[model samples]
Target: MISIKRFSELSYKEAVVLWNEGFKYYFSNMTMTVDAFIRKLANEGLSPEHSVVAYVDHVAVGFAINGFREMDGKKIAWNGGTGIKPEFRGQGIGKVLIEACLDVYREQGVDLALLEAVAQNERAIALYKKMGYEVFEELVFLQQNGAMTIDAFHTNSNFEIVRGIPEDIQLLEFFQPIKAWQVQVPGCKGAESIIVKKGNEVLAYAVYQRMMDEKHNIQTIALNQCEIKESIDVQKVADFILYHVFQPHHKIKRMVRNLSKNNRLVYNTLLAAGFETLVEQVHMSNRLDQPIKESIQ
Candidate 1:
């Protein structure tokens, strides 16, 4: 018989083992130590009360993790991960795991459920579709190394640039409240933001974090969001923001996390700045206002 248990019902060691076993031989290396697993759960706002482990004959075989937050006054839930052991494949456990997630979300009054799947993972994407999830946006992970050659986008406009903490961006009227969960400002604690202003008017903004070496030499920089005011010359403004935020002289590894493909201005700007697409994912959503279809029902 197959059964499901809450992560709270299992010891931390058991939970870690369940996650490792569920994702064993996965397309990506998801194996994690207890500390790393717990840290990830805590950092992502996933709680044991909402996460579950699948068991068969009293042995764990699958797991799902979920997190919740309120955005724009609506409660939203994000599926951090869902996986089943290799030997347990094609046994309907994946569907069970998803249904369990929906139940948890409903219990928590989630207005919408969100998740992302690798673009190439057709099987997983198909399964999500069957579980009432629909892909609404494509997310791309882009990277640029050393210096960028964006001379064509260079401008002589003199906009005052302000450097502030991540919280500062949240206060902006144009701040995007909903996006990929991992790239949200709350998840990017300690990150910085570069706000470009024309006198008193805020024109554009980018949130980023920089890593330094032992000697404090710059290493990697990840820009979580690069938003520009569309009324202005979007391309030119994005170019200016990119040029300033990713100063060409830095010559460090730079990355943008889960940028939406639908966001043409910023996406095109990154492509023009010599950034390459390193990964692609589909952001999916399932509104909970309607009845969620269950296979067994």
Candidate 2:
């Protein structure tokens, strides 16, 4: 028999053990030390009480990491991750965990639940679909190593680009909130934003983070979000945004986090810059408009 327990009941060390076990065969290296695990919870606003772990015969064999945030007056829950030990696969434990997570979401008054899964993970995708989650878009982490050769975005007296905080992007006339969970302001720790304006009208904006070296020189640059008005030349604005966020002068590693493939201009721009797709996932979301008690009970 299987049993589910709130992660709050387990020690961080146990969380690490269960986490490592849950993601043992994941697409990427998800191994976590106790310190890193704690940091993730803190940085991502995940709570032990809101997450769940599975056990069989008192041995933890599965887990789900969930997080909550309020956006646009609606409560949103993110399924940060979910995994089951290889030995425990093919059973109905995963389904039970989903039901438990739904319970958490309902209790927390979540308006919507979102998650991402590796595109190649058919079983997981199918399971999520069965649970009423719909695949909305493809998201990819694009990467480029070594020096960047970015094209300059020319500007006359009418154009100016300036540095700003992540919140500034929201002030733009046509800013769209980033749909990816980790890149949003709440989850994007140490991130900064930039805005380009033609006279007093904003044309484009971007949010990025730089990882510094011991000497404070640029070691890596990461672009999290970029948006341009509908009327602007997307390719040109995208190139310009990359030029600003990536900074062609530095010989450093660079990346774009979980960008939606549907955003053709930005996604294609990254590809044109030789940024290879490092990771690809299917973004899924489930509306929480109905009551969960009937289905869950």
TM-score of each: 0.93, 0.93
Off by over 4 Å in 1: 150-153, 290-297
Best by TM-score: 2
Clashes of each: 0, 0
Query: Candidate 2, residues 1-297: lDDT per residue as tens digits?
Result: 889999899998888988898898788999999999999999988878999988899988898889998876678899988989999998988888888999999899898898999999999999999988989889999888886553433312335788978887766667665378888877777999888776777778888999998899999999888877765455566666677788766778998888988888778777767789989999898889654322110
- Candidate 2 at residue 170, lDDT? 68
Top of the candidates by lDDT: 1
Please write out the lDDT profile of model 1 over residues 1-297, one tens digit for every residue: 789889788888988887888888776788899999888987788888888888999988898888888776678899998888889988999999999999999888888899999899899999999999999899999998986664835778777889998778888877776789988887887689899887788888888888889998879989888788766566667878888777766779989999999888989877877889998999999989655333110
RMSD (CA, angstroms), candidate 2: 3.9
Poorest lDDT segment (10 consecutive residues) of candidate 1? 288-297
Judge candidate 2 against the unseen true structure and give its global Cα lDDT, from 0 to 1: 0.82
Off by over 4 Å in 2: 150-158, 290-297
Tell how far residue 41 is off in model 2, in angstroms: 0.3
